[model samples]
Target chain A: MEAALPESARGGVAKPSSEADARRRRAFIYGLIAFLLVASLPFLPVNNYIIAAVVRALIFISLGQAWNVVAGIGGLLSLGHGVFLGIGCYTTGILFNQYGIPPWLGVWVGAVLSLLVALVMGSMTLRMRGVFFALATVAASLAMVQISRHFVDLTGGADGLALKFFGNSWWAAQSRTPAPFLYASLAFVTLYYWITRWILNSKLGLEMQAVRDDEVAAAAAGVAVFRTKMLGLLVSAAMTALAAGLYMQFYMAIDPEAAFGLSQAIQLQLPALIGGLGTAWGPIIGGAVMIFLSEVTNWGGTKIGVSGVDILVYGLMLLVVVLYAPKGIVGSVLRNAMKGADR
Target chain B: MNAPAVALEVRNIARNFGGVVALRDVTFSVREGEVVGLIGPNGAGKSTLFEIVSGNIRPSGGRVAYFGRDCTTMASHLRRRAGMCRTFQKVRLFESMTVRQNISVAASQCLPKGRDLGEEVNNILAQMRLEHQAERRPSELTLADRKRVEIGRAIAGHCRLLMLDESLSGLTHDEAEHLIDEIMQLNRARGITVIVVEHVLSVLAAMVQRLVVLHNATVIADGTPSEVAHDPVVIEAYLGTKQKALR
Candidate 1:
């Protein structure tokens, strides 16, 4: 807000003032430049597949960064956060299909519903700890999926809901171009990235991290742990929901299983888990890596004569990364770089 | 001791943990800028009293008033905002963060809004003599340094009343002396009230202006160090006269 820390001190732990302030400012400028570059990539010579893959990666980055707000900073390991995404996607899909609401406005409907779901989920699971909290989130998400399926009249049930871009409105859901969708995803992800960065630098973000590091110590320091966790969950759910709305436009179909599935939940973690949960660029790096791995696995599938080879590759890579670098790739790399700098 | 203002006051407080009575009818007042020592053997309810006064463990009975306001049922954060902060008996720090970051967390998170956190934090670091080790993490510090960081963090808050729970438990004699000097400066120069709970009698005697002796969940003695030091019950509690006489 007040410029930020010094450029040279960017990766180093923040000092009270002086050099760190300059680094913070420089880092912010760098972030803005990076966002602009990524946003302009769809207009470049990249293939449609490459552009689409980048868009998907950006969407994952947004969701991962959102998840970090609650899981990394707030210390709430919500394993079933895909429920918010599912709610968002379905809300937008249903609105666009049944009520002729444009996808642009539908995103808001999805975001609001996700926020409500987060409020209810947070109120129930925010008090639980460790494995209990994780399990509770999974169970709650599972229940939401079941409910969506049971209401087959509104949702297409297991058959899924197809969204046709027939509505009039230049900025609404009528466009068939992947370029706009890519740009849209990039813009949303960039906005989320900056927002999360701002939040991490704010008082609320610090309080959330305090709760994460040590709840008892944070309480002694006067941090309201429950309130911080709730706020983190609300913000996280809203962001995930927005990403889900964008995703519906990209895929053009939504079903309870595809939207709220455990695989989707796992996909949400790939970015953060691989990048470093709380680090600013962790989500982007993790998202890029996952996207690259999927592309590679797809090419390798023809040689290996296997269609679902991507999941196997992902599983093995994650296992290796976790075993060798429990802090994730970006976290380990940053730690090493800092160590080198200190030396 | 500076007679600046009333730092903390407790009126008829009681606490229960399930069926266990942690404290019963505990009432006392702490003066401004005085290092009041609270001492008891293990399971004597000293820690419980500290928790209640610090707003960690809510008292099941009675009110805790600080700086002329009733904070008996106030949330810990509100009390912290009201300039009441404390450190744990065991060291608890942001293990993933470096020492300076841990102290900075207290500054950014606990200090009142718009406070000149940079200057205040720098002053605290200088006072604690922790400037050189700022870049190091909590896990890398020695037992004494880790404890100092924990104390430094509490001191960095907007603190009128500073509560320490066995902060010097594992410190060497030299380290303890250095820390005691800092604690004294916090009171004498800044008018910060201190409630130090410790099992170390000699250090407690040298540091505190007044003494509160607790035993079996109640206040057993309250007075100056010299006066309370010679009390029959105080000596008996500390030395275990029956056991010492038989030996």
Candidate 2:
């Protein structure tokens, strides 16, 4: 590959050459520094408020990364991902409360159940494109919410189920301080990030992107379009379920409205969209920005004694981002940087 | 000499969209290592027949055989995996990927696990004369280059029989001749059978050994290019009633 490059242009041009090697090395160093800083956060002398905010941000990061697998990389544009999250939350909640199963084991059950549900839903809906596919997912999510609400015996209906606290136990995933929860969420986010990276490098990743770009051309190129889409959906669903299980264990409570609502789905998607969709680092940056904005707005609203001010702020921020950075923050920044480098 | 093996056989193929008939009783067979050209005017069902042969659209009544095995109802991807690949008239390269990445993805389908892809991708880029444009996205390349990328992707697959739909529709004479030479070399050197649908009669006449003309959803002429060109019915189809008077 190196022999293919012209000697004079090898070092200067942004095209394939030693520049790619330099770029990869730079990315690795930056990633390592970021990971170390994040891992050390729990041991730092931070207040409870800071720890809580970090935990919440990490949870959203995991959610956004999971959503990015299907929506960004696979280009599925799902609008009802909360169904899988709800499955995860409810499965863990019920098992821990009813059967006295530890959440460490129950999370796997939730992940499996979510994978099955996603397989069925993706098979039926992956054939549809654009708004029709989005509508089908929304309908599926709404149906799940109704079912959860109607089954008062299994779920507590609208009242929701709550996990009982059995002291600070690692098996129960219960902790007195927010540090352990923060670490757990961070671990999950890291796993999700690596999984996304693996998929991007795999053959399935290439096929999914091909299908996303042009289905007819992809099929003509011998890519099994339906199977690739289903695989993407299954991975996304399972990751989202795992994150939801962690969220429930940390919060110790989950209601159907909170778990399966459109708001939850929007929150899951917003970070990825704001970060830069398919890029590896987009969701992490987007998660931080989202959490910071929400925290600031919430504090401001309370100080002003104004109801729904945070909601208005969120809407305004979304409008600003959409208008200025249509490709999202990370995509815009990286594209401009590359353009400058090319010159 | 034993007869050449059949690469593709289309038997009694017919397709209709509601009350409108697109194709009826379209039957033809392409032999191994042969280069066949399909020619017709717009709406003459040339593309529809290509779709049927490639298994994109199901034929209303027909059996398609690949190397003497029936594959009429096979799915499009399955057909491609079974060594049949095609390119569209409107070039459809993967827009998000680079020129080399497009070919690499297609080649990876035929390659077994753990095979190094760099050499295969480089070979395709060199064959398509797209080495300089390897890192460029499809949108950045010229129309002709984009078309070449699509062809490169098709050839990079496990392609034994290639069906090209108007592959030379928008190219200069020199560019068309270059692609024609490439196709010929591919056929001769690699033993890859080709079925090309082209409207440019001159290029088609120069590239293909056999010509199959479609008129009003039926085969009007099927023979060597010189013979089909001289056929009275084919002349009339192209020149209308004045051709009979001139003759």
Candidate 3:
């Protein structure tokens, strides 16, 4: 019966049995462990500074996971993702300040607006490849910054907008301490991570990856190359906007430079690149490593009375990561481990 | 009995690149279930014709029809969905994916809702005799195996007409013969129309019911294998000044 099969059809090499299942099970276990650790963070007698760092790390995880969808999976490296974040921040801020809208409701509005911007940006830039696409996105972000600056009456110009203190109202997303904000960040990051995982395992994800591999071949295989790339950008933009809305509520202020600066884009992308570009767990691990390193450097630099020493150290750390683990730490480590197991 | 329907029709097709004339006023058609061989020397516009028919490039002038429906302006993917599938001369496969995945991805495109994609892929793998290497990537396969994967991918779709471009170019004589037999079996069993562009005369003669020869961008001969072999123009084209030796 097998001999009658075409040479291409003959089952010769044995596939690793239950490998996907085993990996899923392992992921579930790790996720549960991480969730428990986060859930218990408030119960521990941690200092306020420690809690603040954890909240910042959670925010990066959200941003990195969102970036992974567009750059890592869709293969469109967007250097202007910060524009969506700024849009989210400004949308929530303006609505709350002028219309008396609650941040809870305003964030959703911000997300929808960000998605619209993403659609326009993706349509314009997705046609370009590699460096051209990246440059287009950077141009888009810079344009947003200028727009925000020019509309001084609406955006408070360079002075920025500060959220009014509403006496720890959950509806307003205003709280006195870092604990509630930490939990909120934790929830958002967890949701984004699961969403990333679900997408990675779906048929759509397979199509996205097929397009990433070869657009011409993918089109021949009936995958809509442009549509898939746009979908990735939309999803990524929405998630990044959500993170930005949360960041505004937590920090209680936003300025064009703080929200739409080039550094904001770098901050979102660095975690994903340092951890792993495409993997679900990459952003979380990378975000934690980045936040911890930054904190350590900041503390050491202040003790030594050097104002710019922390940024120099941060740059050095990134250079080392790029040199040694070009695939990102998590990706390289997992690859080597898989190879060892195969051996 | 009714005559078999024309599966593909190429009418007055012409293509040009600036000053270079790749094809001019070329026309041919393949009937349903017929195996037609397209043969020409290097730079004969064989590949360009395939590209035009497959919707990869728009013909400068002409119309392509499938089953009497004009599809000259249809997109390549839409053409594939309309039951026209083709393989490339340079065996292109998704190198990152396994052989099974490469076939499955293409096959899944034409499948109607509720069809089992895995089953379709497995059938193609078995038909192409690629089951043994199903888990291997295209990079891991030999040139012959990679070519098989490409052919397998084309056939896995709802292929009413399969256009093969130099599919037997890089294979050993034995390997070529084996592939030719498989192609014959596919045509016989599935009643699929085939248009093969090949440089191997022996393989071309053995497989095709009719031959269409192109030289200097125009059809020089079109007939059965024996008729084409005996055609004076074809002899002159192939032999050049060596036509005296044949005489």
Candidate 4:
């Protein structure tokens, strides 16, 4: 059946199989295992404290993977992704608090609003590359924070709005108990991971990488660099917003600083940088490592006389990893393994 | 004669970056099935011309017509979809990807629907003699092999007019000769219009039917290699001016 086509269409008539096909298959199996692992996290007999930490890590992981669409593969760093997360968190929080709308319904509203915001961001900033785009995004995030703080009647300003859960509604009060929120976070993170995987494998993702590698070359070869970057930014914003919705249920609050802060932005990049820059599973692996480190830090700090050690440790680790590995843990390990095998 | 039977025509293309002129009044045309050589001194705006033709740069003044259709403002991908494909001066293969994957990616962009991509990739790899290196990364390959894969990618993409920018820049004598043979084969057997930009005169002399020489953003000479090589104006304006210094 394949023989009837032209030389270029018969898979070029030379190899048994291509690397991409093999990578896709392997990724699928890895994705399945990851899904199962996340699906089982809530069932573990961990303390509520551990569960809370895990849920928080998962939310940021989702956002980080989403951000990777633009920054990692597309190579357009956006410092304003926190704005989308804040937008989603606030929209859902406002809807739930004012109109008695459930968190589930609010999640939809937040996602739509974030998507619109993303569109505007794409139109304005995605055209710029590297530092210019990053600056634009940072400006946007700052602008959003200013609005959130100034509009006290609606957003509760710097004090932020808090949701009072009565533990009665099924979906609305999922965060009244630790188990429900943990499970929800798990689902959200897993969904984002798979969604990113799908996007990266699709035509859109390939074009994004092309844009990243060489916009001039890609363009000459028939790639729309601007359009690809726009799509990547939109997807990145949407994912960050979705994570915000998941996070809103747990915190039941939205403060400009807490939700729209630069610190939160660091959380997104931490896992992504620690795991790998452009690799698919980098964010997931980084998220897990971050959680383990945080837990250990928490335990160790309480046992000893020291505190505020987690952030310090993270800073040090980031420096060491970026300086020594440069490709993150997954990248460094893979390179070493390949070299070892070759030897 | 009939619109010069041009497969691609670049008309009065000019580009400026902040006050610096990269290309100015750059106009040229390639006919179907003809192997045209674009030669230039260093920084003579050869790449700038190709970029304008391939829609990488929007010409500040003029138009790029493919099959007599104005594509001056088309997006790069759109232009690519419209049958314009080019290789880079630096050999831009998808480095992390395998040779087969690299070819398949380029092929899939233009391949017919309902075809197995794997087989299509294999066929292109066979032509480049890279089937054995199908699973290996471009990083693992030699410079000559990488350049060959780059050509394979352009060929697989179903480009009617392939513009190769400095494909033989760093290659050895034997390697350049072999690539020239492959390019000739592509042009002769498949009727693919090829525009080769090369520094090596011997390889280009053997491959190209006609040569266009650019000096200071203008086509100083355009004709058969022998004619251009021997023209008094070419000798006075281009060759003689820099001949002593170059040697």
Candidate 5:
């Protein structure tokens, strides 16, 4: 602890900032290495199940990154992120299935629609306390599920809408193999990661964090508190919509259960919650860990012949992480590492 | 000699919570580059007036003007960006951010376009002599250091007028003196207008050019510290009337 003190505090000259810069550079290198290792997975001659699972992992990673922007960075804890995803999935699937619009263009339309939903939602709930905000989001999520089921003609009700096959076309965004989705998910994850990082470093990000810590202080510091929170929610929703569009393209199907379900809501948050909230790499690592854990636990559950054992593991994992490593695995590790460096 | 320009004006400001009046018909103006003190006893509405002037809370009536610009309807953030900054009576630093980051948060927002924010942050860190503790968070610092960081944040950019609400509270005598020195340096060297609210009249009298004494939501006296201190009405309201009950 004494070593952590600056030399100037001990009557010596102040140390230069080179040490902080070096730590940042090192962390960047490690993140790059992790990204490369994941990028290499599709090249291996793996079975379709394995490939499909990795694609699913990548999809969740993208969702988690999007969620992190609002919930973690902006401090607006949300449980209804799936509502945006639902909007995207339904918008893209319905447009393409009925009007023959290409998925690529439909995705952008979905993004705009999702942003509008976020604008309304944020206005309604951003001023609420954290738990109240979360509950409001949960209500929104459930409402979206009901809306999906109610609109049978547009959303296909509980039966769902599957995109008409167009063979392998970039315009349709459809692929016979999961390989394309694996790569597409890779692109989405990478894009969301960079976007999250950009936001975290930008002036808006600083103000958002300040607002999160203390609204009065942030207002005093020249931050427009409500505007900052709304902007974060809009960005997060738009990104979630884009990822949902890709999910529609990959699965060729959309259903109320999959789009706005409790399972998906938890899935969307677990990556950031487990990896590290408010960090670009958190979802990347967290999503991978979540998928890996699910696979292992699923296999174990089957051997034990228990019901819903996989979900039980998830709850247990969340409890432990919240208790012992509230910063999540990556956050705790990096914090400790920084503390060590300080010493 | 030309009279100094009015840096801030509060006219007939009034506020009430339920039936209780917080401030009533309060009015004052601060001159550019002058250091003024707002001394009052408890529940005198000094903090409420500070909030109204800083744009954090709206006044029930009247107006607040900055450099003759009516800003009563403006948001607090816009007030800060327009060169009006303030500190809280209760210290309110961003808890998760390090001291440097807290200062930089304000610097990044309030600095003029094209000014290097990092340079301004470094300059403030040096000016506040907080370089040694720049990486530490608010919780890690002592009360004096936390106050320094908060003030450092308030002055991080192009500050024209500063309002400090009980900024000297919760400090030892030596610590309070050191903090006062920092505030004095900011006013003397940078020509920034200052309005400070304090309970310690002795300390404030020495530090400020003028004092506005508030008692029961209205100004009882506004004059040089010496004049206000000797005013009998001020003594009756602020120092208490020594009229004893007849046995």
Candidate 6:
């Protein structure tokens, strides 16, 4: 027997759940359309420069979204995320270059190592609130950078580690063109976005948001505060580590300065912070916007024959955003939409 | 008549901050389904005692048991799972969430798995008379409504022992009385044990069956409202030499 659709057919106003369902449907359609466009980019005869920019944007979204699980949702802002990235890059690069292992298996080893580091770091630092935790993570990241530089034999020291490239070898996860890397990065971004949304809707997400709002109150309401923070840290660490393999594959090399430096650490937070800290789409939008702005500015600077001019403009734009739109682009939009709903 | 089982027992609880004593040898037990008032002047260790009982802080010396099980060293969240819930002197609500989400967070954690969480949240909304303000954030609601949401969140869980810490301080006289009625109904209708800490004597007296008074960091009186009201020690502790001077 066919079941009848449940709504009264006469009423125009929808229930909250129905409204949410409609929104979800609209979002899925939009996402599908957007995915198709991105997937068709490499075939549209676009320049490699543009394709490479999009690829960098996707990696930022993937990494930033993972960091958001810890800093935004779990309310534990960590400044040492670069250590996990470095660990993955170094671990995968070392395993593959020295031991003749494939990066496909090597990334998992990096994930395990990152997990161990996160467990140790989270236990000691998650108890510290706000700036102190950030400081601790910064110290840890600096220590990892020094460690990477000091190990000349394993990491190639200042010069960094490079993969033994066999051009367009699928087994080596190497590619000569940006197209394959773009597709891989696209898949990574897509998986990251879906996983983020799933986590936001899960029970763990509820507990994490609770702790983020008020830890004492969350505890009073029966949430394990420390455990929740640790879980968030672990998940963030493993995911960041997982994405590092692709980063190494795309770049073909990873130096300590590029992998574990403060600049790289700050880069990780930009997408989520500028998009909408805890929202799933925040990083995706922020990543795309940032990459587009950077590419345009960089190209303009080259035309003007001036170096570092783009950086000054980028800083100015970011400063404006931090001062005026403290909630980030997506977060401000959401807040305004909520206000309209109330009205 | 059968006696009610003891739901919470505190024995010889003491706390000291450096050289200053906050509480000294304070002991009390709440019977199941009974409403008790914890009254004390400022600096009389009421807050400290509440913290110890709620597992926010450990007493320098003493024991706390919940429903015949020792919970002296249990984490605050674990204690909550064992049916111990508390509110803050200043309302501690999730400011980012709607009133519905605030209560739903607790209900989701405390309710048995497979139960309809949406139905449970709706029931709590109805029970607390928060249906109209369910979609409003704590910052958007009135002070009374915020207090109601705090209480609602505390009791939404598997709460057998509900402790409210000065939850009615800032409300208007009518609002306080109405909240008192709802709190009493929670005890009488829902059969939950309650311990309320309030500075307002008339309000607390009306809602509670018995009062435990703290003075000079120790229990000075424990009796019915009328009995405690007449006790000379409680009178002296609260009023001191200024009792006749102010009048």
Top candidate on lDDT is 5
Candidate 2 lDDT over residue span B1-247, tens digit each: 9889999998988999998899989999999999999988888899999999888889999889999999999888888888898999899988877776688668777644565556666777888898889878888988788888998899884779999998887888788888888888888877999999988776777788998989889888899877887788988886354333223
Q: What are the models' TM-scores?
A: 0.89, 0.93, 0.89, 0.89, 0.91, 0.94
Worst lDDT 10-window in candidate 6 chain A: A5-14
Which docking band does candidate 3 fall into? acceptable
- DockQ metric for all predictions: 0.43, 0.40, 0.33, 0.37, 0.38, 0.47
> Model 6, A1-343: lDDT tens per residue?
1122112110111135555556656666777898888889988979988888888888888999889889877778888899999999999999999998999999999999999999998889777666877887899899988899999999999899988898998888998888898889899988988777666656677678889999999999998888888898899999999999999988889999888898888888888887878778778877788788888888888999977664575566578669987777777855543331210
Between prediction 1 and prediction 4, the one with superior lDDT is 1
- Residue pair clashes in candidate 5: none
Classified by CAPRI criteria, candidate 4 counts as acceptable
Which portions of model 4 show Cα errors greater than 4 Å? A1-45, A334-343, B1-4, B15-24, B112-116, B241-247
Tell me how candidate 3 scores on lDDT: 0.81
Question: Mind giving the per-residue lDDT tens digits that candidate 4 earns over B1-247?
Answer: 4544688887877778788777777777889889999987787788888877777677778888997888888777777766777888988876545576566656666665776665767777888888777777788999999988888888775678888999988888888888888888888887889999877665677788898888777777789888877777777766663343133
- Give the higher-lDDT candidate: 2 or 6: 6
TM-scores (chain A) of the candidates: 0.88, 0.90, 0.90, 0.87, 0.89, 0.91
i-RMSD per candidate, Å? 3.6, 6.3, 5.2, 4.8, 6.6, 7.1
**RMSD versus native structure for model 3:** 4.8
CA lDDT of B75 in candidate 5?
91
Candidate 3 per-residue lDDT over residues B1-247, each given as its tens digit: 9999999998999999998999999988889999999998899999899889888789999899999999999888888877788888888787756787777667767766676666788788888898888888899999889988988888776778988999998899889988998888889988889999988776788789999999999899889987888888988896353333223
Question: What does DockQ come to for candidate 4?
Answer: 0.37
lDDT of 2 at B48: 96
| Candidate that beats the other on DockQ, 1 or 5, i.e. the better one | 1
Supply candidate 5's per-residue lDDT for A152: 95
Best candidate (score: TM-score): 6
lDDT tens readout by residue for model 1, B70-157: 8888878778767788988888998876676677667665666666666666677777888878778788889888888888888775
Interface RMSD score of candidate 2: 6.3
Cα displacement (Å) at residue A38, model 2: 2.8
lDDT score, candidate 1, position A134: 83
